[model samples]
Target: MDFVLQIINGLHVGSIYALIALGYTMVYGIVKLINFAHGDVIMIGSYVVLLSLTELHVPFWIAIIVAVVFCALLGMLIERFAYKPLRNASRITPLITAIGVSLLLQNIAMKVFSANPKPFPNVISGEPFQFGGVQVGQVTIYTILISVVLMVLLELFVLKTKMGKAMRAVSEDAGAATLMGININTTIAITFAIGSGLAAVGGALYSTAYPIVDPYIGSMLGLKAFIAAVLGGIGKIQGAMLGAFIIGITECLTKGYVSSQLSEAVVFAILILVLLVKPAGILGQNIREKV
Candidate 1:
C-alpha cells in the first residue's frame, strides 16, 4: 500500500514535469535552441496567479487563465527581443544570451518579489479519495487529469493544425520550410508562446502540489524537466511525457524507500546512465552528418 501510494505521488509530480517538458521539446524542435530561461517562466506564472488570487481576489481558475495569457505573451516577447536578433549568429551566442536572460529575470523577480519563499494557496482542498488501502488526494487526481487533457490537446494541435505543420517543417529544415512559403519567425514565436504557456500551467500545478514559491524554485524544476526531455527524447513530444513519468516515479520511490537527500542524486544518476547507453534518448533517433 505504501508502495502504491508512492506511485500515485510520483504520478502527480510527473504530470507537472511532463507539462514543463512539453514546452522544452516544442521550443527546441522549432528553434533548435534550449531556452535556459524557460524555467523562470514558471516562476513568473506562479507570481501572476498569486497576485491575482490574493490581491485582486479573483478565483483560482481565473488566476490560472490570467497567468497562462501573461506567460504566453512573455514567451513571445523573449523570443522576439532576445532570440530573434541572434537567429543567424553562432549557436553559443544565443545560448549565452539565454543564460543571461535567465539571470536577468531572476534578479528582476528578486527585486520585485524578494528572495523569500512564499506559501502558495491550496486551490484544491478536500479529503483524499480512498480505494481499498490506498488514498489519493484531490490535488493529485486533478493534476493527473488536467495534465493528460492538456497533453492530448497539444498532441492534436501539433498533428492536425496548420501552424503545427509549419512547426514540423521548421524543425525538419528551416531553409526548405522558408522556401516553401512558411513564415519561419512567426512559427517559432508561436512555438515559444505555446511552450511558455504550458510552463505557466506547470507552474500553477506545481504551486498547488508543493505550495511554495521562491525566486530560484524554477531552477531545479527546469533541470528536472530538461532531464526528462533528454531522457525520453529531447525532440519528441511523446518521449517527453514518458520520460517525465519515469523520472517522477523513480524520484518518489527513492524518497519513500530510501533517503530523501539521495533522491536527486538518483535522478541525476539515471540521466548519466541514459546518456551513456542511449545518447539520443529512449525515443530519440541519431542522425549522422557528413562534412
Candidate 2:
C-alpha cells in the first residue's frame, strides 16, 4: 500500500515536471534555444499567484487564472524584448542571454518577493480518494487530472489548430515557413505564450500541493523537467508527459525502498544510460543533415 502511494506521489511530481518540460521543449523546438529562464518564469508565476491570494485576497481559482495569464504575457514580452533583437545572432549569444535572463529574473524576484518561502493557502478540503487497496489524496488526483487535461489540450492545439499548424511549420523549417508567408515572429511568440501558460498551471499546482513558494524554487524542478524532456525525446509533445510519469514513478519507488539521497543519483544514472543507448530518446526521431 505504501508502495502504491509512493508511486502516486511520484506521478504527481512527474506531472509538474512534464508540464514545465513542455515549455522547455516547445521553445527549444521553434527557436533551438534552451530558454534557461523558463524555470525562473515559473518562479514568477507562483509569486504572482501568492501575491494575488494573500495581498489582494483573491479566490484561489481566480488567482490562478490571473497568474497564468500574467505569466503568459510576460513570456511574450520576454521573447519580444530580450530574444527578438538577437534572433539572428550566433547561437551562443542567445544561449548566454538566456542564462543572463535567468539570473536577472531570479535576483529581481528575490529582491521583490523576498527569499523566504511562503505557504500557499490550501483550498481543497478532504482525504484521499481510495480505489481498491490504494489511497491517493484529492490533491494528487487533481494534479494528475489537470496535467493530463492540459497536455491533451496542448496536443490538440499543436496538431489541429491553425496557429499550431503555423508553429509546426516554423519548427520544420523557418526559412521555408517565411517563404510560405507564415508570420514567423508571431508564431514564435505564440509558442512561448502557450508554453508559459502551461508552466503557470504547473507552478500553481506545485505550490498548492507542496504549499511552499520561493524565488529559487524553479531551479531544481526545472532541471528535472528538462531531464524529463530529454529522456522522453525533446520536441515530441507526448514524449514529455511520458518521460515525466516514468521519472516520477521511478523516483517514488526508489525513495520508498531505497535511500532518498541515492534515489536522485540513481535516476540520473538511468538517464545517462538511456541517452548513451538511444541519443534520440524513447520517442525521438532523427533529422538527417544534407551533405
Candidate whose TM-score is highest:
1
Q: Which candidate should be chosen as best, given lDDT against the real structure?
A: 1
Per-residue lDDT of 1-291 in model 1, one digit per residue for the tens? 898899999999999999999999888877778899999999999999988988998998899999999999999999999999999999899999999989988999999999999998878998999999788999999999999999999999999999989999999999999999999999999999999999999999999888989899889999899999999999899999999999999999999999999999999899899989999998999888958
Residue ranges of candidate 1 with Cα displaced over 4 Å: none
Report the lDDT tens digits of candidate 2 across residue range 89-172.
999998998898889999999898788888888866698888998877898999899998999999999999999999999999
Tell me how many residue pairs clash in candidate 1.
0
TM-score quality measure for candidate 2: 0.97
What do the candidate models score in CA lDDT, each in turn? Answer: 0.93, 0.89
Error of 2 at 241 (Å): 1.1
lDDT of 2: 0.89
